[model samples]
Target chain A: MTADLHTLTGAYALDALSPEEAREFARHLTECDVCTHEVAELRETAARLALAVAEVPPAALRARVMAAIPEVRQLPPPGRVADVVPLRGRAWRQRLPYLALAACLVGAAVAGGVAVNAEHDVDRQRTQAEQQASDLASLMAAPDAAYHTTAVHGGGNATVVSSVSQARTAFVYRDLPKLAGSHVYELWYSRKGSMVPAGLVDSGRPSGTAVLAGAASGADGVGLTVEPHGGSKQPTTSPLMLVSIAG
Target chain B: MRAAAREEQPGAPRPGALETLLDRVSRGDRDAFESVYTAVAGSVLGLVRRVLRDPAQSEEVTQEVLIEVWRSAARFDPGQGSAMAWIMMLAHRRAVDRVRSAQASADREHKAAVRDHSPAFDEVSEQVERRLEREQVRRCLGQLTELQRESVTLAYYRGFTYRETADLLGAALGTVKTRLRDGLIRLRDCLGVSV
Candidate 1:
């Protein structure tokens, strides 16, 4: 029997076509705007039909679904390449000078004793930053990574990428207002009800990643708060941003 | 039909509201997900229950569909359709998958029984419930001829392909396809769904 692709529009919209027929219709659809519009309308009708059957879900389902959200991971926003690449490139550019200065300090260690310790600190931090960048890259690529993007209280936005299975997380901040004085952005992990200190975040750059302690398995959510230069044992103020770790 | 009785009072939540919630959900907003769940879980579960005919399995599929919505919210395009439609489409797909997989397992257990019981009785009750639930949809569905309604319902609610639906109804494959297409066109028009 000769099959008219147009006749398959309803079956295609309902996803009732056989695999081969479905593929054939998909190919046909690209060349057939009329069929495409027809299919869209059919789908809308089907959706409305589906809506007619709305019965109240079990009461327990609400809590179950809500609890599951934190555990599920979200897809990264579009233009992920654009978001990640430039920041890494800019960081590399900024780090090159510091690396050069560190080398110069090593060379002039005999001239100034103080330069050696400062150079060591810089090297340590640079190594840490590199590790954090690598972690951020891996988290971004992880198929199971759950992401949450939230606006900071004062200004800017933060994207938190976490994997409960990996027990790791990375926070990316953009356009955060530079804090003056001894204040710093500190991270916290809230589990059940209590909050635990995670780490300090630097707000000096236009964009940067903050690597928090890898204990996502134990945490239900992540929060950021402004604290003294060194993080407080407990959050001394309200969170600047609170992101639920569930997807 | 129960659905026909309720047609005078359209009860579906505004599609625009769902669209806005979906946009927020795309931004990784957990609160929006909760709100969206509250808005659509019943409908999603109801659809799945109709297709699967097993409350336990339907619940599992519903959870999976909702989690998928959370994970793939970024892919939702408001330009294409309303969020409710996008969500319902997901529900239908997942439910169909469950139905097909269950059929596959039943075939493995008893291949002959699978053919003998193409569309189970429980499935029919679920379909009746579905029809009774939405008045406008029922009214629209009622517009289709008997052959058209059977072909469409077997293929859609029972998760049968056109060929399977044809086999179940003892009709030609081409005939089933034509009936489904015609039925859907009538339903779309009756429901006043715009292309």
Candidate 2:
């Protein structure tokens, strides 16, 4: 299957994939070093083809484009760890609750899923907490990050902060109905006609913020479902809430 | 000042001018943006025109693409690709998106019929001033197998999906996919571009 996806680099670089396929391949590119390199080279080749067909545009385009530049706002550079430092006191304080909740989720997952070694779980939990904090910081500070909020069917609201350029997404759940038993909330990246498991949240947690697993770039939407512990290979229950990322 | 230095040189832009100009544009330098525009507008417009075929829409898209470069200049990571590749990718994707959106509403058969009659590659736009590049690209394209050449051109220049390209050429979908990859590998080698 991956080899088949590997061949998609040429078509992908040429802009020949269907939108859904393009998104899937883009997610693939984020993980596959070989595809990433090939796509870049092929894109360079495509750019050369553009040079072949280059034509002088109507001269008026220059005036219009220049006139339009002033009204447009340029995006800020990607967030650096140092750039995020200034926001640590206020912005970081504001995000403390979410961070704490995310840490709890990591703690719970490690405790419940890896009960074999208590010492190992503690170490893993600490590492994950640190990772999530940094990931959340950079994601929140991303220049292109956008927030999408949708009402959960059983309860309150779910907001997704997605940074496509960063290929990461973070989720904040508010007032979600408490799950019972071993059921957990599973995050999914809704592609064309299928749902891909993105991550799992500890069951019975009513509200929290956690970064969803996997590449979120080009996902059509994000969906949440109640699933058995450890999560399902595919969504076993219909999504309780579906948030379109197109916005 | 750098733009002035560039103005003294005739012909194609100096290597790395676009990248340098983009860095300036990201810092809100209008003069650098102009230099960037002057360097890339023709290629952006020409690519859009080839894909859209409608001159007015092509111009609008070219404007959008350039403005996008200005707005997202900070997003351009030189580590990922060259400035020209970044700009052209933006232009090509915008053109392909518009055409595909339009196709979603229009008659598919009519669209295919129109595409069928269009030349495999239109005469290199007479307005293209880069004669050496035009000839070099033409020569490299000429070296591909007929199937490989058609697959690449139909998808890249004509904005057809691989499945669509396969259907048009009466080839299997898998064959078209391989040909597109193989064809690009050949072009990449011929052009001497390394990732």
Q: In angstroms, how far off is B60's CA in candidate 2?
A: 0.7
Q: Considering summed lDDT, which 10 consecutive residues are worst modelled in model 1 chain B?
A: B120-129
**Model 1 segments beyond 4 Å from truth?**
A1-3, A77-247, B1-16, B102-133
**After superposing the true interface residues, what Cα RMSD does each candidate give?**
15.4, 17.9
Model 1 gets an lDDT of: 0.66
Candidate 2: count the clashes: 0
Indicate which candidate wins on lDDT.
2
For B29-107, candidate 1 gives per-residue lDDT tens digits of 7756765664567678878877777666677889899999999887765445556778988999888876777564363
Worst 10 residues of 2 chain A by lDDT: A81-90
Q: What is the lDDT of residue A206 in candidate 1?
A: 44
Model 2 chain B is weakest, by summed lDDT over 10 consecutive residues, at B118-127
TM-scores for the candidates = 0.53, 0.55
Q: State the lDDT at B5 in candidate 1.
A: 16
